[model samples]
Target chain A: MKFLGVIIVCLTGGLLLYGTTDFPDWGDPSSPASTHLSDYYIEKTIEDTKVPNIVTSVLADYRGFDTMFETAVIFTAGLACFILLRDFRGKKERFYRHKPTGVVLHVKDGKKTLTVGKEFEHMDKDWVPSDLIIKTVCRILIPFIQIYAMYVVAHGDFSPGGGFQGGVIFGSSLILLAISYDLKTLVNRIKEKVLGIFAALGVLIFVGIAAICMPMGGNFLDYTALAPLVWDPHHVRALGMLGVEIGVGFAVMAVMAIIYINIVSEGRHDEGL
Target chain B: MHWPIDLIVLTFVIFCAIAAISVKDLLGTAILFGAYSFMMCLLWAVMGAVDVAFTEASVGAGVSTVFFVAAVFRTSRRTKD
Candidate 1:
């Protein structure tokens, strides 16, 4: 099997290297990739969409439907991870420890075998002591990271970031909190149900905007149709782009969190590494 | 390709990619893969595709590295490879 893999890799690499010879030189002005659609987009993006960032206008406005479906793809991935990993079967035996005299009690079923006591710790054998430095630093820095993520998402029209990048950044902050403190701490703050809703809601917002355009007289995802109710046609396209970006941001953020939580917990959210 | 810095980054990227696959420790492999991603990010930045570079830095070097570490944490660290 390994030999076959190596042979396949060698063949693929040889083909790719051969293919690269036909590609235009780096930064060639007359390259097909640079000449064909690039010229049109570079020249017309500002005039048509009123957005300075060509990538953003192209991704969110010119190809709004594609972005909407891309957001849906992320949403679907989150749903798939949730479905594949989530375990509904009964949990294993749990042990409870009394705090007063250091006594351990094991419970097999959910028959309320032990009476509730305020002085009892749940005997979290898997729990680890969070690092003081890590917890303190993450607590201080998470807000700033989140603010920067929001900034990236909002300023994507003029910057080098957009929904997908900003969303990943935002999701990373939550994951950082999880790593610094614990899975329980992060889960307590943001419930799985909320993440699921956000995932679906994000895609819904994207499709909803596009579908609204259809009813307003223009084709699907046509932002010009929105001008009658809001702003100039050019500005409407920019606004539509912003709305699409926000939808993509929400979808990507939820999906990243969902995938992380599911993978960490092995589909059972009872405890995580 | 810009010769000096780009070549340096490309060399480091290849080294890291090879090292990542060769490492016996799964955790070490994951970290090396993250380094490879950072190098790729630098290559894209040098190529002037700032949007692609930004996405690679955030996704490849940032979130992907975190995911790799988390996966490594959940799984066994030792590997036959």
Candidate 2:
């Protein structure tokens, strides 16, 4: 059976390779894809949206519906992960450590809870003492990483990065905190409820901005309709794209954190890597 | 000039893909998958898709690798097949 599967895979691969032979060369000027709308986008993106980055304008403005749905899809993914993996039931066992003495305590009873003061710190079941250097370095570096992420999101109009990339970077910074410190640090710092709210709020922001256009005498996601609201009407479309990018950034960041937390903790929301 | 770099990156990508699948340790597989993603990101950059390259680098190489590691940390390290 394995041999048959391998043979089938080989045949499929071969067929795919053969099919690629008829494809246009890379960056062919007259290719169907390039010839269709690429010229118009390249030529008029700046004039239309006032965003220097053609990709940003095209993604957040010209093709607004696609991106709106894409954000919704990411939100749905987080929602699904929450529904499938989130475990509300309390765990029977818990562990805590005396911060000064380095003594560990195990509590078998589920109902009894500790006061959790500065003297005692939560510990994972398979916990090891996190290295001081790593923690210190991450502590110092996380802010810069976060700032860079914000820069990427804010400067999407002029740069290569946009919301998705920036959001992922920001989310990874949070995950780095979890890995360096512990899952509890992350969960305690940013509550699960807050994460869920941010995820929904991000999608809402995108939809709200788009929907607002309808009542303002323009089509959905039409930035021109929002001209009256902003101080600089000439760059209203750029501002709209910026708002949309921020929404996507929020959604992606929250979803990344959500998925990471859920998977690491196995939905217990207590102890994890 | 660009074709050589693209070809080299593509070759590395294919190697990484095959190695990731064939590796017995799931942790190793995750790392290899990250290598594959980085190579693909490089290829995208070479092809003049800076935006795509940025997405690939962050989502594929940066975060996804960490996700894979978290998953492996929770689950078994070795694969059955």
Candidate 3:
């Protein structure tokens, strides 16, 4: 049966390779991607928005509607993680197998034998300390990564990096902290409550920007008419785009980290050491 | 037709995925799954799907590996040869 399964998998992989070969060429400037419905987003975005990331321009302004749902994607992921891993926060985790209430003998420092139970230390023997160099590097890199993510969010009118890429990059840096230090340390760094609040706030901010345009008798995401404070329509549009992008970056980063942490921590405690 | 770097990344992805499915050691299988994600990320980047590559690199290469390994932690990692 295993042999037959292997053969079937191989055939499926072969089909996938054959299909991908017919996909759009890598980095083809004239492909269907570069020629889209919105020419202004691609051609004049740099000069108008004062940003230099094309993908960002497309995501933040031209297609902000798609991005609203994208933030919800992250929010749903966060909710899923919370539902899967956490149980009443303050409650102590129970063992999968029935652990006896009696005391247990543990050896420490080779000379002293200790009996601990009921409320023993939560530390596990297999838990390894993070390397000094690695942890130091993670600490150093985090600020730089956040700066880059912000830059990407800020400059979506001239280049490739946009909200989604910036969000994932930001998420990875947080995961790095989790790996280099420990889950508990990350929990402290990014509190669950803060993540939930920020995610909802991001959506509200996006809607508020839309509401500003709605009263002016323009389309819901019309950036061209969002002027009055700034005479230049371009400036107001750019400002609105960036505001939404920042929100997306935060929501995605927070939610992905939440999911990763939940899965990791649950797996750890479930397997009694 | 002449993407040597892509060829290397694609080869790496294929090998890792194959090894992940084939390995008798469950722990090794989980680790190989991570390697598979990393290679897929690299491959996507080479193809200029930077966004797709970014998500894959973070969620697939980094987090998914941790998830699978954590799962193995609760169970015996030994597999019958």
- Pick by TM-score: which candidate is best? 2
Q: Write the per-residue lDDT of candidate 2 for residues A1-273, one digit (tens) a residue.
A: 999999999999999999999999988999998998899999998788888999999999999999999999999999999999999999998898998999999999989878899898778899888999999999999999999999999999999999899999999999999989999899999999999999999999999999999999999999899999999999999999999999999999999999999999999999898
Q: Which candidate, 1 or 3, has the higher lDDT?
A: 1
Which docking band does candidate 2 fall into? high
How does candidate 2 fare on TM-score? 0.98
CAPRI quality level assigned to candidate 1 from its DockQ score: medium
Query: How many clashing pairs in candidate 3?
Result: 7
What's the CA error at residue A79 for candidate 2, in Å? 0.7
Q: Quantify all predictions' global Cα lDDT against the true fold.
A: 0.84, 0.94, 0.69
How far out, in Å, is residue A266 in model 2? 0.2
- Best prediction by DockQ: 2
Fnat for the candidates in order: 0.76, 0.91, 0.30
Every model's DockQ: 0.77, 0.91, 0.39
- Which lDDT value does model 2 have at A167? 92
What's the best-to-worst order under DockQ?
A: 2, 1, 3
Per-residue lDDT tens digits for candidate 3, residues B6-36, read: 8888889889977887899898998999889
Please report, as a residue range, the 10-residue window in candidate 1 chain A with the lowest summed lDDT: A121-130
Considering just chain B, what TM-score does every model have?
0.93, 0.97, 0.90
Model 3 DockQ vs. reference:
0.39
